[model samples]
Target: MTTLETPVPAGHRSLRQRAGNAGRRTTSDKVFNAVLTIAMVIAMVPLFVIIGYVTYRGIGVIGWDFFTLEEPPYRRAGGGYVAGFFGTLYIMGLAILMAVPLGIATAIYVVEYGQGKLAMAIRFFSDVMTGIPSIFVGLFVYGLMVSGWISVGFGTFVAAVAIAIIMLPIVTRSAEEMLKLVPDEWRNASYGLGAGKAQTILKTVLPAAAPGLITGSMLAIARGIGETAPLILTALGSVFIVTTLQGDPQAAVPLQIYNGARQPFEEGLNRAFGGALSLFVLVLIMVVAARIIGARANKRK
Candidate 1:
């Protein structure tokens, strides 16, 4: 024992070399982190600026009448966004009813059962649909439902359909991604337990992706409500809120805001800002609620 010693390996790095390399890596990490943080801040600047300006202009315009009464004429000042507000709710509700189920179902087909040309075509068309401009969708609906084609004329139901077109792609894509995130092990386990394909999908896969599906649906709803072009061509904008699915044109927040902004009166401009603010608040509430629900669902899972 006093004389015997093992020879050192030729390629073994010394402690000092390893320490220096680790320090260099840590420094590189810090540099990358700082750069990414700066990039994030830069990206956020415009959003913050727009929010601040909108809030400043809109805060003083909110009154009880501003929210509860019919929007006033361009030169008039005592009315509210009541009609458009309700119209937005009605249209958004119908659109959600029409879109979410179809989107989720399409997502399921693509993720679980789709194969070969069918699946490829679905994914291609979904991406294509996402890129289709809102105005084009409006035009198509107008041509089909409003013009001599179907003669449905301007109705909230048609408007809801137009919005649904805009929302479908978003919901489908989001849901597909979410469903894909569920662990394959879970599916294997379910099958291992003798579960049928439909049973496993319904009982295991969907539950795992529920939070994301819900969140994505909420976001799609938000976008649908704010769609002005589709509504213009389909809903056609009413002076008063129409409560029925088939009726005289329905008013919506976006239509009102757009008209207000284009009017030649200070009152109209102010009202436009107020409408924008209200829409912002409503969307914020929905998004926040979605986040809360998603968090809870994730925890439960």
Candidate 2:
């Protein structure tokens, strides 16, 4: 038997040559790094400017008394934003109560259970809803409760509902992404131990995803707190603190800011600046809290 020598294919040699050529055609990664740094700075510049402006204008007015005093009658002459502060907390707490469970549950179903046309449609609509303008949400709620067929019962509850609608899709999408990040091995291990769906989700998936959920919730709270137009249409900005869910018009920080800012009085404008500063501080605090919570959770993990 004659031994035949195998030929090295031209294609293989070409590929090797190309790979070598590509390896030699290197550029310094510094250009990319420079572009990334510049992009980040550009993005952050506007945010810093706004926060700096608000702090500069409002810091003189923000004080310990700002938290304890009531809204000044002169809009700039008397007390602080104590009532507006409590009202904001109340409305946002109620909105969270209305939004979290429903949002998380919807997220779970979409992520783990739904697999057919209905899931696709739900997801498509969720994307659309998440991008819809807040003004439109305000208009829809206003129509339903303020002036539409159900005109008889609009108040804080109505405002909460509107905010819930605004916040739900955000919470759901974030939670779904977080839950999806839980490794399949975790779920598989639970299944190996004969765990039921509910037990697996409760014990394995949710704890792993807690950080993201908390962060999303904080964002929701921040978003709801600064909202003015929606609450203005639905809650109508009461002069005094509201006691009941169905109580008369309720004032919130955002609405108070709008009211004070629009008035002709110099005191009112100062109060508006002060209110904006307070809001900025509150948002910053919440963001810090979220970061802390996320860091702790990650450390535990």
Write candidate 1's Cα lDDT for 1-301 as tens digits: 3897566579885553566478889999999999999999999999999888888878778888888899767897768889998998898889999999999999999999998789889899999999999999999999998885788888889999999999999999999999999999999999999999999999999988989999999988887878899999999897686888875799999999999899789888888888999899989998898889888977876
Q: Find the number of clashing residue pairs for candidate 2.
A: 1
Cα lDDT for residue 173, candidate 1:
97
What is the alpha-carbon RMSD of candidate 1 to the true structure?
Answer: 3.2
Whole-model lDDT per candidate: 0.90, 0.82
In terms of TM-score, how similar is model 2 to the real structure? 0.86
Question: Model 1 off-target regions past 4 Å?
Answer: 1-8, 14-39, 295-301
Q: Which is the leading candidate under lDDT?
A: 1
If scored against the real structure, what TM-score would every candidate get?
0.88, 0.86
